[model samples]
Target: MNLILLYPEEVQASGQILSLKDRRFQHIAQIHQPQIGDRLRAGLINGPIGEVEVLALSASEVQLRWHLAAAKPSPDALPLELVMALPRPKMLKRVLQTAATLGVKSLWLIHSYRVDKSYWSTPVLSPDSVHEHLCLGLEQAGDTLLPQVHLRKRFKPFVEDELPALVAGRRALVAHPYQAQDCPAPAWQPSVLVLGPEGGFIPYEIAKLQEAGVESVSLGSRILRVETALPVLLTRLFPLR
Candidate 1:
């Protein structure tokens, strides 16, 4: 893990010292093999980046004191919301982590024509599982801000009623291979990107999205999996500032 993420409740009464005896402690003890007085990169969830000095270590736990007063600023969050068709159980885990790692602050998981009904019942959608994967992503990127996820189970109601307003005043785009404009140049602007399921959105769905102010865009002839396409579309739309 690039950063040891500490939760708000982990703070001791002094507000400076925190302890870990969970997976994080195991990761530190096994991966880092830290020494007393050695400092490691850390940050508070949705807070600033800082260093935590190792005060004590044991096989089961570790105690750390933060220098939060001198903490650095966290990375800038992306001004984008990802609206994706819920993938299968396995892909869902990766997607959550990938989206969080890439700084997507908002996500709307929606239903599409090709999406399997069984996919919705997966345990990966549980609050705990989602939170865990997102944390893993944050740890990988040394990020602290957690992304918000929304679920829309009905396709028609969401597209016809809610989507237009969501896309309004934003650079909204739907990634479709057919009859689509080439993806636009990278720019830092508020945007909403709609992605489809494995076989892509049906023509009728694309039309509904277009009517809702979402322009269809393409990344050329090669069809990419959802995992590959997400990062490409995000980077192509908004490069690092």
Candidate 2:
């Protein structure tokens, strides 16, 4: 974990003091091995980045006094939205974590013909699981803002009824392998990118997305796994800026 993320409930009655007794404590105990008065980089979820002075430490728990360092502004999130056709259950977890780490503020997990119906029933779809993976991403990137994840099991309704407004006045693109326009250079404008499942969107699905004002774009001739394509697409569209 690049940053020790703390939630509001962890704060003591004084607000400045925090008590950790979960996996975070184990991390401090095993990985950091910090001592009393040692300072660690810490941040409040959805709040400012700062440091925590270790007041007490042990294997089961640790107490730290929160200290918000002035002049250290929390990084701004990317002005982007990712609308992806839900992938396999295993891949979904990794995708969610990557999304959060990359600073995608809005994530739409939608259904497509290529998506397996059974994948939707996985336990990872639960709020707790999704939040956990997103937190892992935030902690990795030293970020605090959790990306908003939306699920749409019905593909047509989301594309026909709700997508137009989402893509309106923004650069909207959907990944397609055949006869698609080449992906564009990175621009710091609000954008919505739709990535398909493993085999990719069916012809009908692509048409539906096209009708919703989403232009089909291609990465290359080589077909890439959803996991590989995501980071590549996002990188090409919006770099390390």
List clash counts for every candidate, in order: 0, 0
Local distance difference test, per candidate?
0.91, 0.87
Off by over 4 Å in 2: 12-15
RMSD of 1: 1.3
Worst 10 residues of 1 by lDDT: 8-17
Query: Roughly what TM-score does model 2 have, to 2 decimal places?
Result: 0.95
Native-to-model Cα distance after best TM-score fit, residue 191 in candidate 1, in Å: 0.2
Residues 89-187 of candidate 2 have per-residue lDDT tens digits of 999999999988888889999999988999999999999999999998998888888789999999999999999999998899998988799999988
Q: What overall lDDT, based on C-alpha atoms, would model 2 receive against the true structure?
A: 0.87
Q: After superposition, how far is residue 132 of candidate 2 from its true place, in Å?
A: 0.4
For model 1, state the Cα shift of residue 228 in Å.
0.5
Measured by TM-score, the strongest candidate is 1
